[model samples]
Target: MSSRRQYQREFVRTFFTSPTAVEGDDSAKMLRSASQLRGMQAPDAWIPDNEDATAPSMREEGVENIVEVVSEHGEEFPGEIHPRIVWHRDDPSTRYEGFQQMLRIADPEAGAVEHVDGFVIPEVGDIDDWKKADEFFTIIESEHGLEEGSLSMSVIVESGAAELALGDLREEMGNPSNNLERLFMLVDGEVDYTKDMRAMTPTGELPAWPELRHNTSRGASAAGLIAVDGPYDDIRNVEGYHARMEENRAKGMIGIWSLTPGQVVEANEGPLPPETERWLLDVGGSEVELDDVEGGQAYDGTELGLEELDEGMYRLEDGGEIHELDEEQLRERLVEMVSYVPSMDDIVDSMAEFEAAKEAGRGAIAMTQSATLVVDGIEVEISTDRMWDEATYQAAGTPIALFRDVHEHRPDQHDELKERYGPEVVERALDLDV
Candidate 1:
């Protein structure tokens, strides 16, 4: 293939993964949207013992601990905390360490094109320690060009003062600022019966902490600042991404759902929006179903042979001859498949038969690992390639192994190949773990 075509193919495959690649009117809008919905902030703290303060090796040990964090997560970026501090502080250090680690990962240089939508907190007291937190956030703001809504505080409403001040803190820090993004108040600690009941039942049911009640009387707070509140126990079920997605979507806040490999097919399989389907068809010239025809024998939920219904439309027939459908139904289905990106699961399922055939040495799946080849230092994924150059591999002294055959022979030749080509040239193949 020519370089231009190769570049075009790569551009499409890797396109949507980048934040900037998502549709937006302009750079400012993209950046703004990212700031509001995509940034992830985590806080960590480290507590040092009195004896450790005087120990000569304490600092070195601290550095090693930070190194472990980075090693597990990858390299830290410039302007982010030097990992040496993961173990350096006491009280608020763990939260601080996590914050730095997340920031390190968020740096573009670190290739963290995506952000964490969750906030991680290390302890309860540290969550309420604002003075110390202010100092830490100040350093963060100065080091990285963070926008408001990019970072949040995991507040712990342990003490009466903390609970009382939660609203105030939230109102103060809700919007974008030079110093920080946002604040989240998480209540964690031993709680009395009255406080628990009141927190759970709504504001008026139980007697409130005097300090907190007095603070509330003082004023109404702004949104976004110290926005996260509630009984810690109730919050547990809603902490993770799936629950948050549902909640956010209900609130009209879902822009994109970051999917794992398992969820991708289901996510993609969703009925496509009419406009999007039209756009994709116009742009990509994708195959469309023509009409409903008897799908030979029903071995599965799907009919074996699919019939195109119209331009960019297809229907599955289960032994029945073509039947006329209302225009509305046809338009709806046309809109669906055209816009639908199959869920990762469905997509994988759709390839099961082909992959099985490839494994059995019958034929290769058009766009899977079965169709990939390692060339030079890159992996040429040929699953999307319209035509295969079977002779090319035969000429290169490389055997045209079926997906299974390659695995069977991989261990024997892999080490030798790596030695001869240098690790970089064989890295892609090795990643297949065959």
Candidate 2:
């Protein structure tokens, strides 16, 4: 098996901020916002966008804004700073312009180089193209007398060849001349990718391209890099944004591109475990939770094996004893029987218990979870037992791992996490080892 490079920080969210341009003699609004973002609480990594977000006529000015703002405020910012530079695989002049800008931004005397973590190369082609960009960073580092491989490279996959380039990374890992090891993130750029593929839709919107996301996730996992989804442009549709995030979460791609600070907050909190436990039931092939049903108005009493006792009442037999329930009580009980998602506290307790079990020479153990409710005057209970082995323990430790990473990178979020998860749970999570 080949060894994967270890990264020091977590990448839950990457916020892209475009450099501000002077408008009709007014001051730069976007540049002011970029400086103010040092106090914001979302992105784990910040990108001063100088490519697609900036107008061609103002790109040189945009580069200056990045240098000026980042040099002054990047130290106080909680996240890593990576400025997106212009690059085109087929265009020599554009590539050279980008190269020259990189040289200026990375110069030791510029004062931004010390705060800059790396550069984001956009519109890259294949593995050779990736190497070419990596070589540029290497030359820049050498020119400035900085440590080799000190500057990292993240590529935006906007073409079919760029999508396929991910698979070639594992084979090219052993090359010592280039800084492929410095590669950090594999970010998808869906809009340009759609144009590159010549794809079209009735609505003229970007396709979901789930295969691309899955491939990106798999490639990131195989190469030990972070996978990030492209931006969800429907900024005002907050629910739609979260729904998209849930989909990306299912594919193990926690990081995403944030176009606004609001989106950044959502993306930052999207990956962490829920604050409270939730239950769901399969109702006619659709999953329904307690929140889905409004006052039990839409539910019939027959769901989840509840025996209807009256027009608005029901009875449930818990191992033979009968307990009476009303419409609202019945709806609540039914949802709890089908599925359960553990909360952060629940995870910490389980991990702590599992550690104790392992120390006591046990390979596996059965853990029981129960839900109880009062019906009429009797207490009815529903319980579940899951066997936890080493594999299961490791799987449950993902949230803990993410928490530790956040705790390490963003000390500003420490009090917020403690307030959310409690100090005991936070401490235990930081101390946990897989």
Candidate 3:
């Protein structure tokens, strides 16, 4: 083969092949070692430090950081002391204690704090109760500045009624007098837009909300800033990060803040690219020009419309309608899981006993009759049955003994029962609704 062709083949084999053949030659190792020695002999073996002091300084001055906020879908609170609407299942004390723990970092004193910000689901079924809850928060924000530097409260936005009245929520947040510096919208269960659909704060996906930073003005964009909780803590890709930061800057999001220095590093990673120092010099305007260098359209800029922002991630927006999958969809997903039969004879016997209990008119007996049919580790109660009918079994949604009846112990009685119930008795038994 030609020398150039061989080189090309070797290069392709190294990267494209699943596994490349190792060269039998050992001379390369010696040559590489000698080269390393040559390098060590040279006095200029040095590591490089590439840290930028300017961008962070600029951000510190006032530029907002772009944060993609998130929170666990099911849990309340991402372990922070931001605002939230708390609800309880017959117990408000637990929710109150949770807020107290979250605010422990703030050195919260129990008695000095005047009012507990919470609301009860009115028994009259009137949704005015939710309005009352929101009003309570407005009252707290209006009053708390005199005593403590901050107010911490939770509002539970979980119910059909609350979901419908989400507009009431948006209006409260929109109110200029209501100084809700940090608002947390806690969604517990399915909320209807008509009753209680509130925009999520600390916002990103459903539960991950950016902390709502309050602005002095109450115009359309008054709720201008959102701070993501638990800021980034890793700095693996500084260049890609700064590029995103420049994108966010263009999008009108201002400075980024982290509670910990570690998070600051993570947040800085993307905004501060690998060649950020050089790129900063290259772009060298009032704001970094990430789009010009990379040659792709800038991350959705401020000039772009909200419909364009939809192409990115879905976030909680005030006065917008959000729809989740219906119960049928949820059930369909659950039914997709695999179902397997068990292999325990003792469980089968126990289930048989339980079946006997049912035939005896003892209502429902709990026992292990078969490995497949079990309750709390005990099997089905149908003792004499074997090899259940797969089609009829699944259609019935319950287990029926394949062969014998409860009176198998008394063959004569078993025959009589079969005559009365007929061959389809097992099917009838299976038809009993769980």
Candidate 4:
């Protein structure tokens, strides 16, 4: 396949199991995660940790972890070995360390070498971070013999500043070799909740739901990056885990991450699957019924072969007439199709099946958009691409909390904000509103 098509296709929907590099075999942990899950949808890739928090020896220990992983679980967990580079804002300057980390991976004679399929830069918030990312691409393509497109790169959205600067960061991606495909918003992990967000759940759900929704859907999607949901901390909370995964999936997140062996299955199956026996349809209200509804719905909620429906626009009953309807007519009459309730065991199986279909390129339900958010008490509209709808962001009751969070955490960057969106708008939201 050509590069462009392959690029868009492979990155769309894939779970990543991030095993701690300092301790056990991360890849093996991921394999176990997949195996335990009913669908057993093996992960698309395994990203080993190299950040200060997880691994002991930094990037070198991470590479060693991958080598051991390939040695022990080569046949079973043959996903890509992508190491994360440190880019924490609190650090004086960690972006430069990212380059060093890449060098450590590329330096085969130095002996910390492993197959470096890709890289993930954590806590990326500014233009300098983008420049550092670009430089990494240049070194891999120029010094090491590799096509930039032949590899995939990811960036984590961890800070309020990163959340706010997503647009500027996107425009900076003029370089084709950047290949910064995955944009994971950190839902959990060593996050300073007081600064970046207000919630701190061990489950995959966000502390601040509205902000999380905007970042995962608007900023990440609009930036042409696949949005990955973060890990759920408490591995024992299976019910909470399922709920969090379902919530993120509803918001257009392609996948979530796993830290331990047990989280693998539920982590991979972020949301439960599309009920094979059920029909999915939108509706005017929660109380919508099928009686007077047009053909956009299933007849009486009985299980019909997916082939029985023409893309959910009409029905194909055994001897019934083709109840065809146009898009406009379908829209006019469409009502929420009641979801089939799945038992606990059924959920386990369905999550796996849903994961399989998504991997096979047949899954991925559409996501809905947020209506409004209270940012510093003012309402801000979140755009479809998942970025702040700037024109209407300052609307009444839309809270520009992310903006305030950025301003509060990093006051030095206020000048940059003033320069980008003008001093008046930034000041009004930050100073007067709050």
User: Backbone clashes per model, in order?
Assistant: 42, 0, 60, 22
Q: Residue 200 deviation, candidate 3, in Å?
A: 21
Query: How far in Å is the alpha carbon of 185 misplaced in model 4?
Result: 9.0
For each candidate, what is the lDDT? 0.30, 0.77, 0.26, 0.47
Query: Best TM-score goes to which candidate?
Result: 2
Q: Candidate 3: global Cα-lDDT?
A: 0.26
lDDT tens string, model 2, 174-266?
687667998898899999999999999999888999988999988889888889999899989998989888898889888888888888887
Provide the lowest-lDDT 10-residue window in model 4. Answer: 370-379
Candidates by lDDT, descending order: 2, 4, 1, 3
TM-score of model 1 (CA atoms): 0.26
- Cα RMSD, each candidate: 21.0, 5.7, 34.4, 19.1
Estimate, for each residue in 324-423, the C-alpha lDDT of model 1 and write its tens digit: 4444454443334332222223322334444455568854334322122211222222222222233322321211112123223224334433454445
- Model 1 bad stretches (over 4 Å): 1-96, 118-128, 167-181, 184-434
Residue 340 CA error for candidate 2 (Å)?
0.8
Which residue ranges in model 3 land beyond 4 Å of their true spot? Answer: 1-94, 99-170, 174-235, 255-260, 265-434
Error of 3 at 272 (Å): 11
Question: Lowest lDDT 10-mer window, candidate 3?
Answer: 9-18
TM-score for each predicted model, relative to the true structure: 0.26, 0.87, 0.24, 0.53
lDDT of 3 at 228: 19
